[model samples]
Target: MKNFSDIQIGNTIGPREQFVSKDECRAFAHSSGFAAPRFTDDEGARKEGLPGMILPGNMSLGLLSKFVTDWIGPEGGAQLVRISTTYRVPVQPDHTLVFQGFVTHSVPEERTAEIDVWIENEEAERLVTGTATVRFDK
Candidate 1:
């Protein structure tokens, strides 16, 4: 939103795509202190009964944040004050992830709003769900 007043309940951002290869996820895991084997190696993930190396929960959250920010654009007038997410499935590497969000509540007087967000795979499986509070600076 260019201004806080532009926000309306039920207004949506996107079903935008975010993709990461095994190399990218591994690089993120290693740098961010989440470099456990299951997140770094397919073999290690198999040992844990997973099909392959997967992104950790924190990485998923970061991707969610990126989605919101990208939607807000470069000259953002909104500040994501708070965000909470629940992970439902493992986010696999080299996959097309979709990020979508909608406003659930709006407080125009306070210049704040609550947004519901979710990330799904190409197959339409929800990998994570979350809510965020954003304040707009006029």
Candidate 2:
């Protein structure tokens, strides 16, 4: 198990790129019950002046959560007690999505910490930003 305290503030966790495919987007849209044409149809998105098909905001956060969980592992489970995020830009299915996070603050007595999270592209342009509270206890 990795120690959460060892991770420093402003440290980048992952630039792990994930390609959001059309089939994946459609499946997610259906599963999430999101009926927005921007997330479903390429033509609709283009007509709306968007680049292409857009991914759901929650889906991006879901990817972030997965990254956190994987980092924390079994013996060191991080309970995501709270999260605050803003979608700065649309995530196109054709582009690679990067999930990155950093330790912002630590409260050892409370066995909790705050982390700033973001998703960016290869060019390092931030598409989303957020804060997350993680609880570490045995």
Clashes of each: 0, 0
Q: Evaluate model 1: give its TM-score.
A: 0.94
Residue pairs whose backbone atoms clash in candidate 2? none
Q: What TM-score does each of the candidates earn?
A: 0.94, 0.87
Q: Let me know the TM-score candidate 2 reaches against the reference structure.
A: 0.87
User: What would the per-residue lDDT of candidate 2 be over residues 29-116, giving only the tens digit for each residue?
Assistant: 8899985889999999999999888888888777777777765776665687887879998887777878888887888787777888
lDDT of 2: 0.79
lDDT of each: 0.88, 0.79
**Tens digits of per-residue lDDT for model 1 on 13-86?**
89788788999899899989869998999999999999999998888899888777777788878888888999
* C-alpha RMSD for every candidate: 1.2, 1.9
Best-fitting candidate, scored by TM-score: 1
Clashes of 2: 0
- Of the candidates shown, which would achieve the greatest lDDT relative to the real structure? 1
